[model samples]
Target chain A: MMSKFITLLPEELHASLQNKYNEGFIYLLDITAVDYSEYPQAKEEAYALVYIIRHKSFQEHILIKTYLHTLEIETVTDIFKGANWLEREVYDQYGITFLHHPNLRRILNHHQFVGHPLRKSYPITKGQLSYEVDDLIDEMNNRLLSKNVVCRLESGSFSECNKDLMFLNLGPSHPASHGTIRTYVALDGETVEAAVSEIGYLHRGFEKSCENHSYNQIVPYTDRLNYCSAISNNIAYVKTVEEMLGITLPLRAQAIRVMLLELSRIEDHVVCLAAVLVDMGGLTNYWYMYNPREDIYELLSKLTGARLTNSYMRVGGMTNDLYEGFEEDLKDVIKKVQYGVEETLSLIKHNRIFHDRTQNVGVINAQDALNASMTGPNLRASGVPFDMRKDTPYYGYENYTFDVIVGSVGDVYDRVMVRFGEIQESIKIIEQVMQNLPEGEVNIKDAAITLPHKEAVYNTIEGVMNHFKLTYEGVKVPAGEYYSSLEATNGELGFFIVSDGSGIPYKVKVKAPSFTAMSAYPDIIEGSQLADAILTLGSLNIIAGEMDR
Target chain B: MEINTQTLPLETAITTRLDDAIGWARESSLWPMIFGTACCAIEFMSAAASKYDISRFGAEVVRFSPRQADLLIVAGTITYKQAPILKQIYDQMSEPKWVISMGACACSGGFYDNYSTMQGIDEIIPVDLYVGGCPPRPEALLDALLSLQKDLRTHTYNPDRHKDFKGLLDDV
Candidate 1:
């Protein structure tokens, strides 16, 4: 077993990485940008800090460092191939350049985009569309604000002069391309020679929105990131903040977090598997798998007030105790979903179309899979025995026993099989948690951060004041940086947050596994037919919100 | 299987100019372009499935290419980057087309307060009807379709309709 390293660093450490750090292997987890206008002179410089984690043996952990300047850093793509997309993301969100990186164009936005929308300096509200020719003239003369960047058209498509390659934009609107994100593929007919994924067609800059709101106020925003599994997002954010505050949730709260995360895993995998089935031309299986998924959503909604972005987990604990009759409702939902899962498995597990479509298509050998930095089902499909929940337990995951499912053939079918196996495993995990339900306070009794009882607030004036202050101003996290990762529905969802001991976080950066998995799309689509391309894309289950964030 | 007399007679020929117009309309039972942008797109998927069964109204075949489609179902949020693509799709579609701006985000940007999201998709393209709800239920999406069909039956194919609807949200 490799020792997990969690090193906290000051600004001087940034210079050390630039000058002397040469690794056995280095992986840039994610970068978080912070506004420093209000901080003291020592910390008053706007910076983007990235967590560089090293992977070894069965366990993987990382060290942290903060960078003061947005100067172009040496591309880590040459070192740890996984850093390619992470560096591009830093460029996209913070306008920080990463030198010596190939294909450094915008990954999330259009090429001719004006501003880095994720930066705090950018205005939050939408501006009026200025059509006056005179306004353009004034801007050209440097007499007025630049209106061109607000609502502008980006020109230039791929050139036809290059006979060797052609560019195809895959579905900002196309059926196979789920939602609004598009992948610009440079191809020689069916073979994708190279690819650039253009995201931010759905970029809402969720990180920037978190700055204006308080800690508790930002749970809804996390919901939109990976809307397929909002519970995972909630867990990541709350856990990271919990680390910063040194707040330990009660036993019941930890168990509830585990239960919710497992259910979310089941739902996320079901939809992904069903969608992949449809992509492979097995519609009957798609509909069959989806029926049980509907039941899961119903169960989720009954437990929490909202279904998708449950906001169930709070900083210290949950929004409220589980809704009454949740146990009975959950049991029925579990029973029906189990039946639905078996029916779905039988429908497509032996089907000819599914086998033919997925077996040999988009094969990624284990070495290439590691090189491309694939994770979750995709990496497991390539026969990598890695699962965050099993390997590195968080939020009571280690207490439950389950297999870390792996596959031999790293194709679409193997990925499906991994998710299918994991869904059964998730059910096993949830079942255990339900039966061995821990008896304790649902939330920490600390009233300073969380609100006191409604009765207490109504009767006592201090309780009322505590509630108001916590709601409006939010809880102040201690000044420090904390890194935490949870086994999200997709893969490892990590949060690297830097707190300035303020109500609002200095920076909260999300490490979305789907986004990293999406970086390999161009590689997966190479030499495949157009329809196969759709199958691989859907099978990957790349979420645009997470990708573009 | 015996055919019901209540079912309309099947016509094989679509040769004449008049027949082409009527036949296209019959085919146009309004083919909805899958404009699924986010979570609401899930409900849109359920609507197209066997249970809700959108094929009952003869509008189930979703065309991947916009050139073949006449109906655009705006299923979720229209972000700033997504706005241009949505407009381009609407522009590529044939005339006498209808758009169902489904869900709150497509209608008015929903809970999004960021600069990246467009307030309403109608600012970029014309919408025939708006379906409300976080994700409007399948029944709501079906209602939008019925409403669009009603409007389509009343109005003939008009070239001027495109120009009138272009950049439509001036006063509203």
Candidate 2:
């Protein structure tokens, strides 16, 4: 296992966590809990709260686990501001209460939902519906009054207001947002006094669903994590499972996987850039961006079976080999994509309107961003050059020569420009993969992991038996636990898996990047203009499927 | 109140039933209120792209407001948390409106039938069409629009009340 687990007492969690943070563990990767009450190997403890922290310099992951006798523990929110939502999610799922945590409410499930749905005792099909909307009036009012700001934007003067602070609800079904995020902002004139966003509208019990499903069946569910870059989620899930099974896929599979990862990365960036631009009243960019994106979809539809959600990864390898003449088509698409990117660049690079709107719009200082545990391009946008591909070197990323794109101000402009820079670098990586494409069997030779051919199944009794056993029992993942992550579209989309020598996983907690992004949203949007807030939200690319999942 | 066909020029002259003319008008100039939440939203964007231009049907004007829109394309999964919002949006749309449930998830909750996800959105709101696929392709969305258009072309309207204008209450 990549992660070294350290058992801790509940009393020592706060002190030890502070000690580690002092010892250069600046990044908070994820906070999740495992319900081991029903597991065969578990001891007397009913709940185990796991905190995965990392060193600021590199990917030195440490898994600190503390078993809770009861459902209460000290909150680490004071140390890590991002722990607010992470703790709430843990509490919502496992019913492990965090003591002295401010505003510890249901983060993923509705407030009306009863019992922690992720508990082994909770029924999978028992669902509850909430009729009343949770207006975060108390929360937003405090944040607005506590700040006590006296001034406004640098160029504009702050006028004394006669009217009360106007509360505005922007989403949960607004046109500006992605239709899942709801933010209630207290506005003074056009400036936002305070804002509180809520998610979980699309929380379709992904973790609960993963527990009931076998390893292979869960691939399709991961496809919806960040549907724009679906394959990256697939790779993130399958890679963890593959590591647990100790299977080394052929070199050909690794090359193709990297290629698809870069391709999807481009696709994700294009969608983000185009959508944010359209928010700024530039619909022409959507045409330019989506044209190449649609061309990429054309190639992907041929590569995978589906257009949007391609569940193309198996345990040890890709579902199938790449079609012949794929390189020609891929190269052609890349050229067109580059041209489209250049057009958008010429239109946006020195444009006055875009610069004025995005330059200092939603600024989050590097310290606040790091405190909130932001990762990927968002972290990199704040001038942090930490990339999983570079730091961890998964899928032979170290072998490729490309820059880890960074930005200075960490505003909306930097965020958009960083994605544009990354799309170019991804093209470079894809071209490198195509140049030295490996030639070998995609799947590993292990009969236990790979499915047999149709001819073999009909002709041989061994094949029939093996297929049946693998179908019913699933690929036998040796009883163990591992946390593996990849550089997904948003951030470090990690899968923390616990297996118990059974067909189903004991627990598979997704460390979705967008969740962390949402945790940092109120901080980013506060004290900014409402119009700029909309642009900032779009620039953040808060995909609800991934955020809620 | 009939026009004189002999007085009108052949180029501009046309004759059709009022119901058929109303159906054609409703089908042609559809202002779609897109209720997209997940992957199908991305596909909807693809349909807005050049390869599969949805503007060709005169349905390009995607009004986020329920009051302005005539077609409701409910795309992606709607969980219990979002059920009330979906119902409110459905209720807000005016009469003579149509609903097209766009993906498997919207049609029957797709593969996610668990504690959080609803079995189908139809449990809360009536649907006119159900496009199938994990996220039915951009072309498939276009096909559903066309099918809905076909239904609207022959839909029997009753001015008296909503009772006579029977919807496509089939198991979509």
Candidate 3:
């Protein structure tokens, strides 16, 4: 039954929250934001007006939205500890400072990071710093700046900390940080006191760049966001545009998209699983996992032409039909994948060393996970059966019968098991798609949105002109706002597009799963030993591409 | 004494026998450090798997700690942020070590040209052999192994040419 309640609170408490918490109570889903660029007053008001959502059922959602003006926006941090990073992120990206935020240094960018990168007015070409190795040599030779030019960059009373607490900068160089993300971890002896993730080291202002490029051009940039699973990103972005345009993909096209997505998921998970094993010092598992992944890539290359950055999905449909020998090759690869998975499980999953390293490490409880807005395997490991595919039933996943795997103890070992179970489920999905392969047009005949056939483009005059125009000047969508979220190999990969009925998106905000998952580190690592932090990080599998983006 | 030099085929035979024994020792036990930096690093892992089975060549153990390794497979894109660390790891490895630069990015920074990437790993460290392709297939990496094995047969440590690329010769 649906329950509704209306209560009048004391004006003083309501006013304080409205000013401090932006809107005090988050009612609906976990969290959401509304762009106020249209209102001139929004720029000065210091509040972006956020909605906190609590989901009850499929279509039932409750929203709690309030407006708080400044850093006077006091920390709800006490109520939701996970908000520590999210508030910091909202501040870092939008320049919306939250009051009582303990440490609000730039999370995404470097210390020398010039400006707030996510502001709508931020220029794409201007204010970007370029560094080349050759340039470094030239600078050294010029003598305008000495090798050890001791500029007093920071001269302030910043030394107010416990003698027991030591600050450790873990990355922007370390192998395990994967990309350019650095963590400023404050440690009390061997246990972590507090840790903050620093991002924007690889920030290229992609969102701003999207405004300049056409919808088609934006696909290539999105590929670099989560380079490990480029296909999933491609699918998410296209799906958002499709929702806005109000177009339905053909049956064959849907199957093809699912096929490619599952393959990408397999490859992405294999690499991450391999990384964890490699970090734990059992190097052989890394070897066994990647062989089948390579075979999958071979299929990808044959089907999409490029392996990693395959911009295969078009707006209305896919770029091309499936290649002739794809099914036969896919069947062969599946056999190899089965063999590889078995070998990996036997070699490492049950091994004593593997268990000792991963078990009881980086534990997160169910309530804490929900409060933090955790999704994907990280949340699923904590006993939340919230798979986007199963929970929301997207992309024909409802047709296939698969279990939503969960672990009792939300630790590193559980995350591994959840992923392992998902891989088996993914294999089953691919097998079903192959068994029930349909016969029809792989791409739609929406000439306005999709490019013409190659034969028509080469042979006919109108087709030639249409092809050129579509390639350079992409088709525009009707003015509307749409959000699409998919269960990526990592987590909930979402795209929120704001269109102005132009070829370019007015504002495109990507809610990357890694960025959210990494935000919860401070909460997860609160009482754990320092060495356990690395183990916990590997379990989360936060790809810097997505996190920094 | 000059007339006697024309008569001995036995002396040449013994020299050839000694050379084969030395080559066998050099070919076996190539310990490669796990220097995987990107996607090609994934393929390097595959080369060590059961199906590809790199154990036949006696090079299966991908040492995590660099001090014990003799071969450095420079896999994936070598970014500017990553270059110095790569150099330090290369320096830490024992003497008589060789570098097999794997993939197009490691050979020459694949597609990223604007900034952030180093263009080529050879610009930073001396590469023994360069494997080409966006990310060369695992089988292609196996080919790199055979080529690195050939390099071990002829090249030896020389202090004079340590920093001098001008004096180096193509073994092929």
Candidate 4:
């Protein structure tokens, strides 16, 4: 079996993971904990610590299940640096303590937050009385003021150097950080001595909401995660649920999904690269990029009703077929995007200022990036040619011809360039898919899985009864757990679902790419200038929606 | 080329109160803070972009600093952790400011009525207008701004006026 459950003493975790690390499970994909207190079948353990790891060379992945009957479990941060925030997140949600974890505190919810909301026992509507706004600000300011760092002078005398290191809060509502991400940087003049990012400013408790919502009802919520590429998020989520149900999509549906995924990829990259340039004082490029993005949105609006939140994907297939004239509209959008990409390249490719601002700044070495469990373009830029699309070809990604773009000396410039290349590759993929469009039904005809047609529902008794059951109770997925991932616009967008043979998912854990990418921000910006820090953050493309959720 | 304004009667002149002039000036150039938290932020950007062109309504100058802005367009979902930060930003903005809660999330938490999201931004700060959509379209956001402009023109600066305007605060 690819996955195995091993019960080990709390102290044996470090040694066991060390053995696994040597065995080529070098990359840690995710570390999450699930509470099984309410489940009568799980009498041996109250919480399950789930660890997903991947081999560096073979691309083989394994799920390591370790059940914890006690509150405390060994911290894997020593073995994998990326486990720092992952452990904290698991702790924050499941209230399971990770022993010896560095800075093990709340990662998503506030430090003042009450009961772990991910626990089944926690009330969904239970609200906490947060500190007064003014008081919170005052307290934060006081804490910043009180933070003292001693620096040794040239004469070898230690002196209080807090005055030299100015602590600047760069977000929560800043133009440069894009969304509601706050990076507290201790600046030595313009150079950053240290940096720490505080997220959860956009945490809507998506997991908790998922537990309460039915299978299909959770589609809209998926749109909000990685809103730039809503279709990709939608497809990633539904694909996971579909996998658990062991459903196979039609060839046409798969082709359409690939098309949309590439389109979403182009959209995400355009926004990210444009926003990066804008942060570096290239306002003209924002217009150049967004103009095409607006056209894509128009096409998307025609395909689905909404422009931004296109919840287009269903469990078995898609919610609706491509609208009439969709091909022509899509062609027009592709042309526009191509024009925009060319124009953007001309404007910034040779610009000396752009190079000076981005090149060699916020460099994350390949080893550090791997240790941080970075994925997608960010990891690829660090000289790691690990694209999930290439590694584990899903949704017939193997049928498509594309290059896995990689860059050496990972920096802001390399990251931006990687995205630029990915955009071009996505356009190529989209054009290829359009040229060889498949013909068949978009959704599966299985009455038990997909909803019945309206005509059949109105005319036939069995159809009416089937539609009612599907609509009211939703699809009853067999009791099983599955982790499905896709090459999301940002990176490996994964959804880990635990089903209990019910219409509602027992546990829904979103392994958001931006979440992991954002965790490495402090490390990336440690020694860079304040302006370059902004540029690096922009290139990271850490969407607060995806990160916090 | 100077006209004989001294010869005209006081009533014949373009007579207006200082408050009316202030209201007109404030209404014309309402600088909104760029405070977008989620998907609605994208639509908000589109409104400010070349297509919808929010500059036509004199709200073109999108200020990143709260101290400089006069309007707070809360453009997406505001969570519990962000509520205090939003309140702080609102407090920082100069007085006689207006807020346009753009999108269903900011208006009433939209589909995410969970432990993290605030039920509505109005629970923390007073809102002058609420644009409705999971993420309202750019045109809806523009309409909200126009309506906010109308409110700014007619409404008095007195703090007590907000109490009478409570009916407008109903869920969109």
Model 4: DockQ score:
0.47
lDDT of 3 by residue, A1-549 (tens): 111222222223235434433443321123333444543333434334343333523223333344444433555566565566666666765676666676655554334345655565555444422222111222222211221222223673233233365667666445576655556665668876666555554544556667677897788777767777788889999888887887888888888788777887888888888878777777777767877877887788898887676777878887788878889999999888878789999997668988887888999987677667677888889888777787677678888777888887889999988888888888888999988878899777877789998899999999999999887778787765556678888877877676767788876777778876877876687567877887788888887666655
TM for every model, in the order presented, reads: 0.85, 0.95, 0.75, 0.93
* Number of the predicted model whose DockQ against the real structure is largest: 2
After superposing candidate 1, which stretches have Cα over 4 Å from the reference? Answer: A1-26, A32-35, A58-60, A66-70, A126-167, A186-189, A457-460, B1-28, B56-58, B149-172
Listed models, DockQ each = 0.30, 0.54, 0.11, 0.47
Which runs in model 2 stand beyond 4 Å of their true positions?
A149-163, B1-16, B158-172
Q: Find the 10 residues in a row with the least total lDDT in model 4 chain A.
A: A133-142
Clash count list over all predictions? 1, 0, 15, 0
Which candidate number maximizes TM-score?
A: 2
Error of 3 at B154 (Å): 8.1
Give model 3's docking category.
incorrect
CA-RMSD of model 4: 4.4
Interface RMSD of each: 4.6, 3.6, 7.4, 4.0
Candidate 4, residue B141: lDDT: 87
If you assessed candidate 1 against the hidden native complex, which CAPRI class would it receive?
acceptable
Per-prediction fnat = 0.45, 0.80, 0.06, 0.69
lDDT of each: 0.71, 0.87, 0.68, 0.84
Q: B27-88, model 2: which lDDT tens digit per residue? A: 78999999989889889988878889999978899999999997899989988888888888
The residue pairs found clashing in candidate 1 are A108-A199
lDDT per residue as tens, model 1, B55-116: 88779989878888888888877776666567778879987577888888889988776676
